[model samples]
Target: MAAVTEPLLRTERMALRQVTRSDVDRLVLLNNDDGVMRYLDWRPPTREQVVAEVEILLKAYEVYPRHGQLIAELADSTFVGWFSLAVGADGPAAPELGYRLRTAHWGAGLATEGSQAMINYAFAELEAERVVAETMFVNAGSRRVMEKCGMRHIETFHVEFDNPLPGTELGEVRYQITREEWLVARTSR
Candidate 1:
C-alpha cells in the first residue's frame, strides 16, 4: 500500500483530518475527561503531552501516511475525537484501527461513522488485505462500534500491564475484517 497524501476525509456528519497543533486545547479537554478515559491506560494527558502527541501525529503524516492519525470534527467544526490506521507492533502487513471520542458523543454513532470511513479507506485506497481493532473487554461501547463497522470478534487475549486500568482483568477482545469480507458485505448490502 502506498501512503495517502491527502490529510482529510469527509463523512456524512463529520470530517476526518490530520491533527494540528491548534487542536491542542480541545484534545486536552477530550483526553482529560475521566468518563472518556475509563477504558484507557492512563489518566488525562497534560497540556505538554497533548502538544507532543499532536506533533508526533503531524510527523507521522510525512513518514507514514498510509498508517497515520486523524482528528474527527463535527459539521459545525467541533473537535469530536481522533482515529488512526497504523501497523501493529507485531507486524507491518497488518494495520490496526483505533479511535477515541468525546464522552458527550457516545451513543450517537459517530465512532461507527468515522471508523467505517477509515476501514473503507484501508480497503479501497490502501489495498489493505485486512484491518483489525481491539478494546478492553468491558468497553461495550467500543465493541459495539467495531461490530457496527462490520468487524467480527477474532479472539480475546490477555496481556500483562504494569498499571492496568479497571476491567483489564477481563482481558481484551480483538475484532477483524478482511478486504474480501468487506467487499462481499458491501455487495450484499
Candidate 2:
C-alpha cells in the first residue's frame, strides 16, 4: 500500500471521505433499508453490529493506509452512501470494489463518478496490480457503474445464498481492470 495524500476524494459533485463512528446512526438506516440491501446476501444489521464493523475498518486503516469504505457526501456535505475498496475476495489478491447508496440517490451517476475516482486512486496512488468488482447479474445499475469505470466482465458464477434476492439465480458477474489495462485506458483518453 502507498500513502494517501487527499483525505477526501473529490469528484465534480461528491466527496468520498473516511467513515466515522458518528456516521453510525445514518449508516444504520442505510444499511438496514430493504431496498439498499436487496442484492446482498445478508439482511439489515443491528446498530451495534454496524458500529462494530465500523470500528474494525477504522482499526484496519492503521495497517493499510488506503483500504476501507469511503463515505460519500454531496459537495454541500450531505451524506449519500459508501463505496468500499478491499483486498481480494476468496481467491486472488486484488482490490475489490463495492458500494451502496440511499434509494434517493439512485440513477444520479454518483456511483460511476465515485467508482472511477477510486479506480484511478487504486492504479495511480496505491500502485495496485488490479481492481475488481462484482454484482448480481440482474443488477444492471451496478454493472453499468462498473462498466463506466472501464472494468470488463470477467466471469458469471453461482453462489448459494440463504436469503437470495430476485435474480440471484442468474448468478454473479465479476468485473476487472488490470494496471496495464488502466494505463492504456488513461493514455487513450
Candidate 3:
C-alpha cells in the first residue's frame, strides 16, 4: 500500500493537498459553475480541457514540488475548491495565488481563510520575496479577500481577450504583498 503523504497546507477549516487525477470530476463541476467561472475562464472548461490541465498539474508536482494548484477540503473530506501558489516564467521565487470555492460555500469566509494560508506558505515556507494575486477589476469579492490577507493593490492593467467577458472594459487588477509587509502584518496579528 502507498503511504499517505501529509497535506501540503492546512487551515482552521480546511486542508490543502496536492491535486490528483481522482479530483478531475470534482474539478470539472467547479470549472463548470456559472458564478465561479464568471470572472475566470468566462466559459465552462470541458472535461477534456480539465483532464489535460490536471495532467499538467500532476507533472508539475514532480518537478516543482509544492508550487502548484492544491485541493482544499474540509476535515470530513468535503471538497471546497482549490488554491494555488503557482510559478510563472519568473519561477518559484515569486508565486501567484489563486483560488475558487464552491458557490455553496460562498459567504462563509472560506476564500479568505484559504488565501491567508497560501500567503503564509509563500512567505514563511517558500521564502518568497513577494506574493501576488489578480482578478477582474469588477470582482469585488476577490479583491476584498486579497485586502483581508494583507495584500495591497499594485496595478490595474488591460488585456485584450479575443472574446472578453462583461466588465472586462474595466480591466484587471493585481494585488501584492512583499515579505517585509507580510512580516509586519504577521507580527501585528
Q: How well does model 1 score by local distance difference test?
A: 0.84
Tens digit of per-residue lDDT, candidate 3, span 13-131: 99899888888899988877659998987588899999999999989989889899989989888889999999986678889999999999999999999999999999889989999
Better of 1 and 2 by lDDT: 1
Q: What value does the lDDT take at residue 80 in candidate 1?
A: 84
Q: Please report, as a residue range, the 10-residue window in candidate 1 with the lowest summed lDDT.
A: 1-10
Better of 1 and 3 by lDDT: 3
The weakest ten consecutive residues by lDDT in model 2 span 1-10
Q: Compare the candidates by TM-score and give the number of the best one.
A: 3
lDDT of each: 0.84, 0.83, 0.91
lDDT of 1 by residue, 105-171 (tens): 8889899999999999888887788999999999998999999999999999998999988899999
Mark the regions of model 1 whose C-alpha exceeds 4 Å error after superposition: 1-7, 90-93
Residue 54: error of model 3 in Å? 0.4
Q: Give the better candidate number (2 or 3) by TM-score.
A: 3
Error of 1 at 103 (Å): 1.4
Task: Order candidates by TM-score, high to low.
Answer: 3, 1, 2
